[model samples]
Target: MNDRSRDVRSIRLPRWGRVAADQGVVPWLVFDEEGKAVEPVRRFLIDFVARDNRVGSVRSYAFDLLRWWRWLRVVEVEWNRATSAEVRDFVLWLSGAVKPRSAPRTVSAATAGTINSITKKPYLDDRYKPRTIRHSNAVLRSFYDFWIELGGGPLVNPVPLARSDHRRPHAHHNPLEPYRAEGRLRYNPKVPRRRPRQMPDERWNELFAALRSNRDRAILALAVSNGARASELLGVRGVDLDWGDQLVRVVRKGTLAEQWLPASPEAFVWIRLYQEEGPPLDPTAPLWWTLRRRDHGAGLAYQPMNYEALRAVFRRANLLLGTNWSMHDLRHTAALRMARDEGLSLRDVQTILGHAHLSTTADIYLVEEESQVIRRVQDHLAELKKRAQLPPPPVALGYQASDLEVLFGGDQA
Candidate 1:
């Protein structure tokens, strides 16, 4: 056993190989000696997120796994050796310490609820909202699956750690449902205050004035005119623009729909300016680049600006304008202006917003005609009153008051 241990240690076997040997199995699979199972998992996540163009989600998952990795290190357990019980304990630790410690500004109940829901294990308290726990569950499941595929150790699936009924009725307590009632397993619907829509002309002027760099200006123009999501905007490339037709192609996430948006004249101008001044304007170069800073000096390869950079610009602009708004709110502002002021149909708004469903566009851009319902009810009441005012048909000759009383009640008598 001592000689065998020395041989195993001296071979400089890969991480997965070590895991397999520890599990009493001979290692045959070839893998990187230095690169562990998590390394491939990271690469896979990077490619998967990039292909899906979900930069925010990718970053979030990366951080989540990083936290898990840190916890594993603190516990002195090799990641490959982690069992379901250890995972559960870690989740509990995260629910009590990590989440509360990390989000101190949140309400106590809300924070507790968040921790419970995010972990999704009923063994832990289920009071919080479920988004973070659900996300963590997905990340961990994927990580373990990848580890197993790489021959790390005995395959242990963690998804069944939480019991959830998939086919429960809407009234049943289910956390996944969006419109769940209070005291149910899901979060209560938030009643958002309706802010008056921004005037298009004012927004346009402010956007132009706030954005000085060609790239920033172009981003604002594209977002306003095309009503593209941040991810869609980030995915745009130089070749996607058709200057002649004033069109820009975007790869919409979820469906991977390639959509060509009609670029307004203003959009065309800004796009042209960005093409000239930003990045190299190569066909494959990103449409937006970070503004060069004097401290960074010249000739350094300019990094492409991501979605967060675009959001920062919007945040700064909102601060200057004294508005509690975001870049997404700008899209809403554009949709509202187009639907209400430009006299655009819901379908037109749908096209502008790249909505796969027209109903979603309608909900966002079309205001309910409040008076229409009242008018209909009023018209119905008026018709009833008119009928009531009509004289009774010349009562059949010799119809007695007693007969009328029998038909119309004591008042007629």
Candidate 2:
């Protein structure tokens, strides 16, 4: 056991790998199904952090690369020599297709890797959702690019057809993605960009009205008013708020950095009320829950309210709301309200939302072009007309078609 452990330990590791070993982080500990640490996988993940990628991004990339590893096996191609055609087929598979027969959806072991990871239910389904396809393609393309850069057998990236990139992200000020003179990679798949979901005004009003607890009201108000994520709002410590400046410093989720988001006047009032009713002030202490009586009196002691606690609040409030909403809808609601109602510019919205790129901000909060609006209206009207012209559906029978003859003994006809 010691010799085996020594062999695993002898593998040269980067800084992130050492950190993963010490911390036992799951995402950073990816290995093949056979429990062998592939050197390429190890180096790629380490490089992900070397490029200063966020923890969440590294985790996602790890999973995507795992799928790619499985794909290599199914294609009967070594990882070093995969061609562009296989990459294209992988992307197409992710976009899903109707089956030809009572044909089992399992096309290949590689595809099954993706399908099983994505939903796992629908046991044999080979279909990939458009969103899933897009995400998978991105990760795979990036992995291939990295492999080529590492001089891993192939000189060409094999992720073909770069010309279809209409995602002409305007030269924006993201430091991580500098203007590549040769241009960045893009896959040409048409996935519908769905609008961000927001709570309707009526539902929003009903939800707030249902909140009888000061803490619940304050928690939700901060989320909506500031466009802060649930974790950001939940992570608030007393020191993070500057009441005089009407700003709350949140350690933004995913991107671990503090950002001062402006708070509504009502937010300040409710938060203060909740704070007063709960524990006494300690700047370093989490502003949310108080320590239980047994755990009290410890310096800066706290028990920050968890996701389930906040979820329970929403679940109770749901009884009064005609519709349901998650905590994230608050962020979306704020984003839309800022851009559409308050006339905030894209750059300003980006700043408020802590988005890394202006293109990301633009994608979410797009104003339809006149032609697009007209086309949408036409489609909607056509749908209405189609519904109006439809014949009523046939009434359902309590018995099956064969049961009708069997139960009634109706050869009498």
* Tens digit per residue, CA lDDT, model 1, 1-413: 01111121122211122111112121111122353445544554644554554544555666666656655555556766666655555555544443323344433343332322221212223332345655676677666766666677445543333326544334465577575322222211223434334444655676568765777777777777767878888888888988888888998776778999876788778777776765566688777777763335655667777777777786576556544345665576577767776666778878778788998877655774334456899999999999988766655677886788788875343
**Per-residue lDDT over 189-260 for candidate 2, one digit per residue giving the tens place of the 0 to 100 score:** 767655675566776878899987778888888888979988788888899999998899999776788889
The regions of model 2 sitting more than 4 angstroms off are 1-27, 97-128, 164-188, 196-198, 210-213, 252-257, 277-282, 285-324, 340-350, 355-413
Q: Which residue runs of candidate 1 sit more than 4 Å off their true CA positions?
A: 1-60, 74-130, 145-156, 161-208, 213-215, 255-257, 272-284, 290-303, 308-312, 322-324, 335-413
Clashing pairs in 2: none
Error of 2 at 330 (Å): 2.1
TM-scores of the models, in the order given: 0.52, 0.62
Listed per candidate, the RMSD to the true structure in angstroms reads 13.8, 14.8
Question: Relative to the true structure, how large is the alpha-carbon lDDT of every model?
Answer: 0.59, 0.67
- Clash-forming residue pairs, model 1: 113-127, 113-128, 113-129, 114-128, 117-130, 118-132, 118-133, 119-133
TM-score of 2: 0.62
